[model samples]
Target: MSAAPSPAPPRETRQREVISRLLQSAEGPLGVPELHARALNELPRLGVATVYRTLKLLQEQGAAHIVTLDGENLYEASGRGHHHHFSCRQCGRVYTLNTCPVALPAGTVYPGGFVVEAHEVTLYGLCPACAPR
Candidate 1:
């Protein structure tokens, strides 16, 4: 038999570690600029390019995923499990909604035999902090 495949090398660098920690601890998904700015607090010398590269690596490794809101891309750590997102129209902050309201049964089929593999729902409104009483 051929030699066993060698284990993949670790991709975690100081910059990557800082970025990962920020993503993991964030209250919700963050855009690239936001992520970069937050990472600079921990790693002053960190470059935005490094943040983009680290995010790509994380996405490739399935440790992170992207959510598009209001035509902008935001990143969040994976493993949150079957959740959705909400955005505040006033403050432009995105929040994670842990409950799913859609009740589409598994293997949902639509017109033209289209199979629904997955779904994402984004609700738009003012968040609690931004809402007027």
Candidate 2:
């Protein structure tokens, strides 16, 4: 049987537009503070709460992805799945890795009969610009 359709997302607002623009223009995941700061350029009234709420709504709608780095919750635009990310230690820049390095042999199973559904990998290092001259 076909699955039931999901409810439509909430109506768009100026804050949502600002948050969406920031997320889409970002090269990697962004935290609430960063999103709010950048959004202020176009939306001076943008607040942290609005950014958080918009991010939550976007995530629930599968329009964004939540990434956790060092216990920090970050959000990024969706559609870049099945890959990994790279973070520069020197400059604190995050880059997308087009390759996925996870491979499991056939018949592989968890110790408690658990199933592997998905995984994410984050690499840390210096970017080309940040590398030693």
Candidate 3:
């Protein structure tokens, strides 16, 4: 008897949905709990572990990113290749800047033989609403 074909990959579907909700929500970055809760709205049985796993997959495929700032791990959409980020301390909000100010002359900063694949730029401070006078 012939062996039955393997089932389709569920991780891909879950990962796509995860990335879609993240971009549509546009909440800068979200923690696992927050992301998982949101995913549950569409997928009632979504689990936190699945959320983490899918997020890792998304990061590996360059579809999303995880930012660890001030002891918090947050996830965000990353289809624009790579970019910088700004997060508010008081309000606990996050923002993605259009570009980074820090720049290095090509072939100077990086090691002679090493290749620079990607970089993460992050800044943390009080946002406009949370700033103190």
Candidate 4:
């Protein structure tokens, strides 16, 4: 007989709810520090360790994912679907690019006969506010 799937994680606590809402509503992915700071507004006594644990749980549950930009890891809700990111060097901020520019078809074969299963693209440049007119 096939084994049954494991039970889902316990229902979210008040703290996890705050963290999850922040991730879902953020304009872009947020690093731990940013997420913690924002969460503190609603949950003044929230601990950094709790934030770390909650993020880990979210990732394990496929409710969130990490985006690494300029060596910093950021978190965003998984419901965003297929998309990429852009990093502003001057502002040190990462933004989500809702529209994908890549047109590669699935199962595309490379020059060496390697098939493309997935891809990630990150664009780096100055954001509008940082760009010189």
Candidate 5:
């Protein structure tokens, strides 16, 4: 006989829906306050605690990743493949860069015996809109 399928884990329906909307509408990492603010439009009862808890759960499940910048914890959906990020200083907007400029030679090693595996680069600058004319 075939093996039985595993049951799904318990879900927080409203919280999940809120997270879905945030992930879908966001183009970059979103802070909890921003997420809550946007989600509150549709879910009047949405709470800050729910957003935090759901973010934690989603990060644990690899469904989302944390982007820390300027002492703030921002959340973004994962599974987009290898890429870098850029943060605008003036507007405080985060952007995803498709190209990775760092190229290491074969058998390169660090001074502390650390081997390179993967890396994430975050560039800082003024975005087009915020740049001086």
Candidate 6:
């Protein structure tokens, strides 16, 4: 006989738990592979594709946020207040700053017809640990 369909996690509960874990262990944002790797330790049967799908869903639903630059996307739990990123080019590690310093002041002039909803700032350079030896 065919196996019955598996039950889906309740969205609010699953998203909240995911966010809590991501925040508690946050070294920075996590990419899909990293998220999957971490999830494997918790939800062993979770697939990489599922991770990507969940991330996308979270981003769309404003439950999680992503910081992308140079073709890679990094993810973190949302509702932590505004946040920004710092990337260590030497070691290729990504980190989050407590406060964002690079963004322009709100109400700064922009093209008349353009409506800016959100902006992501990614700083590239060596992190303290990755400084030249």
Which candidate should be chosen as best, given lDDT against the real structure?
Answer: 4
Q: How accurate is candidate 6 locally (lDDT)?
A: 0.73
TM-score per prediction, in order, is 0.89, 0.79, 0.65, 0.88, 0.80, 0.69
Residue pairs whose backbone atoms clash in candidate 4: none
With candidate 3 superimposed using the best TM-score fit, by how many Å does residue 14's alpha carbon deviate from the native?
5.8
Q: Which regions of candidate 3 fall more than 4 Å away from where they truly are? A: 1-19, 23-25, 110-119
Comparing candidate 1 with candidate 4, which one achieves the higher lDDT?
Answer: 4
User: What overall lDDT goes with each candidate model?
Assistant: 0.90, 0.82, 0.72, 0.91, 0.82, 0.73
Q: State in Å the error of residue 80, model 5.
A: 1.1
Q: Mind giving the per-residue lDDT tens digits that candidate 3 earns over 20-111?
A: 66655674777787777777777888777778778787787677776787788888887654467788878777877777666743444455
Kindly indicate the candidate among 2 and 6 with the higher lDDT: 2
Tens digit per residue, CA lDDT, model 2, 1-133: 9989987768988888778877887878887877788999998877778787888899888889888887888888998757788989998777777787778534667999976667788999898899998
- Cα deviation of 114, candidate 2, in Å: 6.6
Residues 1-133, candidate 1: write the lDDT tens digits. Answer: 8999998867569988888888898878999999999988888888889899999999988999998887899999999999889989998888889999898766999999999888999999999999999
Ranking by lDDT: 4, 1, 2, 5, 6, 3
Model 1, TM vs. native: 0.89
Q: How many steric clashes between backbone atoms does each model show? A: 0, 0, 0, 0, 0, 0
Preferred candidate (lDDT higher): 4 or 6:
4
List model 6 lDDT by residue over 36-71, tens digit each: 777777777777776777777777767777667678
Q: Candidate 4 residues 17-131, lDDT tens each?
A: 9999999988789999999999999999999999999999999889999888777889999988788888898988788899888987679999989999988888899988899
When sorted by TM-score, best at the front, the candidate numbers are 1, 4, 5, 2, 6, 3
